[model samples]
Target: MKHLTVVDHPLVQHKLSHMRDVQTPSHQFRQLLRETSHLLAYEITRNLKSGTREIDTPMQQMEAPVLTGRRPALVSILRAGNGLLDGVLDLVPMARVGFVGLYRDEETLKPVQYYFKVPEQLDQRQVIVVDPMLATGHSAIATISLLKEAGAKDLRFLCLVAAPDGVAAMQDAHPDVPIVTAALDKGLNENGYIYPGLGDAGDRIFGTD
Candidate 1:
């Protein structure tokens, strides 16, 4: 109950509602995911490092506050996380992208990394990790560790819906990092799925099943 951070922006709330509806088409669902990311990105990057520069407008020359350095990197958690990349990218089109593929190990109940590719010199840049469902948190927890090894010191975790258990795991393991989510559902089920969850994100988004 305490670990979740719900994003209550009207646009985010509206899109999240559509995202939960089963009738949403794959195309629309993907579109909504990207749009929601824009809203969520607003909250996560509210404190993005920026600098003021003197620039000339059509009318006159004045100091303007612009984003510092390049756009924040979008670090997708692979599979389902990709669904969120488009939404966030719509807001930060120039942001560099990265991917990490992790699957669960049944016996260990931990994330097993299959692949991870981050932008070069990520240590100097802020990173936003995107995954639609935060179910068990094993993947997010392990992914954060892996990201740190790759020199990602400044990181933010973003999810569409997070279970209480997953949020706790994330908060407990990575208290330094902030989590931004649209909805914080009740809890996880016996199969380690968030109750009333949107089901398998990758499958739902990609229509594989």
Candidate 2:
């Protein structure tokens, strides 16, 4: 799993357990997702470029580290992805935001792009593509392809839970892009849902269905 990263922090794991419970309400579910996204953002940005700048402290002058280069961009895959986006944005308030709306076709289980928008100069900035679930990977792959065509070079995929099938599909399609996820579950069940996975993230997050 060289391209895969499972965030196993105690706090993340604990929150994830709550999110998986069938009895958890939509409000609580969204809260847990936000809290968990904060942790995931921290892990994903651990290696972000930084530079030192001189600053005057209350006591004396000193040098402090600050993020370098253009602020990183967060591209939400839409609907469900927005859940993670809210939390990431809380941490990276200055990050350029983008949105790519893709819905899965029930018959084909393929991604259909209905909306797509991203910041300019994507090639010059690191981009984190966010979504709550990586089930079949078709949507992730299609979205990444779209980003690449639009000039995004450095990209990473973040998700709350992923199925092995989804991870494998992403690896096959975009091996260069690392995947950061909370849990890599057994695999997808028929109908393309991750097994032992928390139910549909969009419905849970938005109080729909």
For all candidates in order, the CA lDDT equals 0.86, 0.95
Give the TM-score (vs. native) of candidate 1: 0.93
What is the per-residue lDDT of model 2 for residues 1-209, given as tens digits with 9 covering 90 to 100?
A: 87899999999999999999999999999999999999999988886789999999999988899999988999999899999999999999999999999999999999999999999999989999999999999999999999999999999999999998999999999999999999999998779999899999999999999
Which 10-residue window of candidate 1 scores lowest in summed lDDT?
1-10
Clashes by residue pair, model 2: none
Among these predictions, the greatest TM-score belongs to 2
- What's the distance in Å from true for residue 72, model 2? 0.8
lDDT of 2 at 135: 98
The digit string of per-residue lDDT tens for model 1 on 144-192 reads 8888888888989999999888888888988888898999988887778
Model 2 accuracy (lDDT, Cα): 0.95
> Which candidate leads in lDDT?
2
Candidate 2: regions farther than 4 A off: none
**What's each prediction's TM-score?**
0.93, 0.98
